[model samples]
Target: MENLKKTLIKAARKAHQVFDELKDRPSSDPIKIESYTGYASQDRMFLKGRVLEDDNIMVTKSYEELKRIFYSFKRFETDEIPGVKVLLYLDDHEFQVYTDEEGFYTLDIATPDSINVKPGEWIRGYAELPDIVGDDGPVRGTIKLRVPDSEASYGVISDIDDTILQTHVTSLFQLKMMFVTLFKEASQRLAMEGMVELYQEMSTTPVGGKNPFFYVSNSPWNIYPMLVEFLKLNELPSGPVLLRDFGFGMLHQNEGYRGHKIETISHIFRAYPDMQFILFGDSGSKDADVYLNLALEFPDQIKTIYIRHLKDTKNARRVANLINQKGEVDAIIIDSTREIAADAREKGYVSEKFVLTEVEADE
Candidate 1:
């Protein structure tokens, strides 16, 4: 009898240990959808977004609430909820994919010939999370394809930092300044003077048509929504904003941080093989170096290179020498977007009417 009692006591202790360990385990989070802009082509469509199980997500409707808006960045930069089922609805058809380890899902789907889309036309796409998600329906997003407009003379591709927005990325107090600017309301953030005018001129076309503007930034995808709001507030030309995934760790840089920009640009080049591109970036970072290499690599596709001088005269000189050696491409360094507007007019990259109207509006 004593032996049986001892066995019962042992079992009770084991049960208690198991219960204690189970109580400490973290609960699994339900899937939440975070969608981004997608691009489509003549016969193919590419869509991308991240699936997260974040419970603390709070979106600020107004830019006035700086503290609430700042916390939204934290909610997105956290770990991706992997292995979740995601359904993408393109028009009437549907495509299914599972989130990868990083909680990112990309769909490269071939479109039926019946679904005819034109250049600059925005296609509606819905990212449907599993029923386990709390949302009522699939998250909606827009798809922009590389439909070459015969009216579009060339396409404009630009960097977001000091080139268009004052990021101070190369400043000695970069991190501190970034923290201050990032937390501020988007309306409070300052846009580079005369940049919108220049970009608008570049996006101009003959016969009341306009060229496409593509923004390729090194900023992480976590802050993408905020960036969109800022662009709208500033009245900048809208286009595909391609960004990188910084992943779970705040300090961890993605392995492709150095080459991701070029890789993305290469994809754009391939998508629209016949379209010529004008590149823009700030000289403060590796923009000059990367763009120089890109000009050489895609000599026929690159039309002109514009580098915003961020006190990096030395790098600018190197870029000019290299481009001059090539003899096929034009590269210039400027202090403001107004300089680009002047250059664009002289080079016939944009119509004189567009430049004049932009200047008048600013005045």
Candidate 2:
């Protein structure tokens, strides 16, 4: 019995050592990379990258196992790459490998022990920059690739102005000033407290196998870099960002506002009909209304909708009423980002999870 125990321990140690070695191996060939400056809202930005692939990839393990493998890369970060992060569940995870002197990080994933991820479950890879305290900080970037054994294919569709950056669209003048400045000064501002947590939640959520995050914003294209810088400063999650170009004609229709957020959501739903979505936005605009409408229209596709309350407004009541009327939707509205996170742990959305922090005065 003692001999058998010793053998088991030795095997485990050997397996761990092998994993460590595998984590450190470099890619065999240089791959083509594309970089984009992604804006989360008016206040946040993320530097995102993707390694294009023409062939199908396979991943081994259950969806849970695949998620775990992706996350296992977390043990390998050095001080030189502060922005290096990992997202995983079961056997699948993504790593933000170290960057070069040019401030670029490449992603390389080894074929898994088994191939379980179906063609529909494959997803692109992405990373967010590390939060920097000062305005003049370095930019952090990430790269992604397909792995063997993955069974899910996914993509992200997110809100832009408030969800990614700090732009408050409700006040059109402030929003315009934010645009006029090109978000230069504002992008350097500190991240809102709990924003990191909120972003982390968004990035790591399990969506159709392993899709890349897709960000949709109302801000015009010129300030895309500013938004990316803002996300780096906040150390938020990274994904493919879609920004509104002023020339897109919709801006002309919205009275100078550049994005058709509702339409964009509809487009995403149409694009990936089988994919699940984890929606993030604020109460300053029509996010709540849009998400509510989405829940009504496509009940199965949306997994969760997280709305951050910027002010004490009737929007929360209206959201609640809408949910009550439909009797569907796993949604919540909260004064702070942390509360929204806490509620996420519960299986279902409870009123207590989204209760307002402020109290109303008695008439």
Candidate 3:
């Protein structure tokens, strides 16, 4: 493992070197702050975004879908702006942050103790590059942060690759995964059969409110924009999307190296201690083991777990053994959305209308 990590680091350094050499030293290009949806507690706010020299590639092509695949490669070949100080404004408060070597900035700062928010409400803010100017003022990034409602029953923490989106993470060399992730546009990408409806149903609360959904994926942050667009196009319930850093930065994080999903979900759980969660993953990854063990540790907070069956016998058997070992939490393998909906109905996690409306349709 140590040797393999060293090799990956060396390769990453080379890639970074290549990117640095290819970019123009001083150009008239515009710099922009690309922000993602953030989540917050009453007393603290957690946020992240990137500073990059905008490529100015036209991403939208209503007529030609394949053009996006060509542009996605350019997004991966990012023109990062590093060591730049950024200013973030939340209401009347101000916070200062700086971009890392990868042009990514992460903020976990204290909010005013007097701040009050109802769970499920979104707080709006903005991030600005102090040095970058626009027609009126500095170029800014609009930020939205979600505050979980204590009144809600549970939130969802789901895997993106196979559980929701149809990225074949199990394919040889992950070639199929790369093809779908890179070559396909957001509209061209496929969500699993019935997953769209299932997730939509899952988001509907009994009081007609929407429960929160957090997406935890091992996908690098470079594809954050692509994934966000994919969710919007597919109409999946959007929340804070916690993706890993790419290249050398990924290897340095101790917890992230152990399991990105695990570390990310644990942080979410800690953030909303009173809120229960319905865990979702696929059998293709180590999701079963990670989620199952988490259920043991936070048995009270985890309502149940659903593992999307991918026909991996060895992994399935291993998950089965773990499930048997800790039968306190309800964990099951499901081959279809219909199965999950049926189980969820029995447990009162979802509405009767959801199962009746979702399962009665074609698979």
Q: How do the predictions measure up, each by TM-score?
A: 0.79, 0.48, 0.89
RMSD of 3: 2.7
Q: Which residue pairs collide, candidate 3?
A: 119-148, 119-149
- Which is superior by lDDT, 2 or 3? 3
Query: In candidate 1, what are the lDDT values of residues 1-363, reduced to their tens digit?
Result: 989966876776666456545544465755567777766667666667887655554333544466655575665446566667777776676778988756788886675676666776776766776545354455433443444465788888889877887777766658845764557545556666778777766676766677887889888877776677778878787777888865432223464655768888887877677888999987767777777777878888888888876665566566556545755567777766767888888888877654433342233
Q: Let me know the TM-score candidate 1 reaches against the reference structure.
A: 0.79
Q: Rate residue 223 of model 3 by lDDT.
A: 78
For each candidate in the order shown, give its overall lDDT on alpha carbons. Answer: 0.70, 0.48, 0.80
Where does candidate 1 stray beyond 4 Å? 1-31, 54-79, 109-112, 131-150, 248-258, 313-326, 353-363
Q: Judged by TM-score, which candidate is best?
A: 3
* Model 2, runs deviating above 4 Å: 1-156, 170-183, 205-211, 251-259, 313-326, 348-363
Candidate 3 at 37: error in angstroms?
A: 0.4
What local lDDT does model 1 show for residue 248? Answer: 31
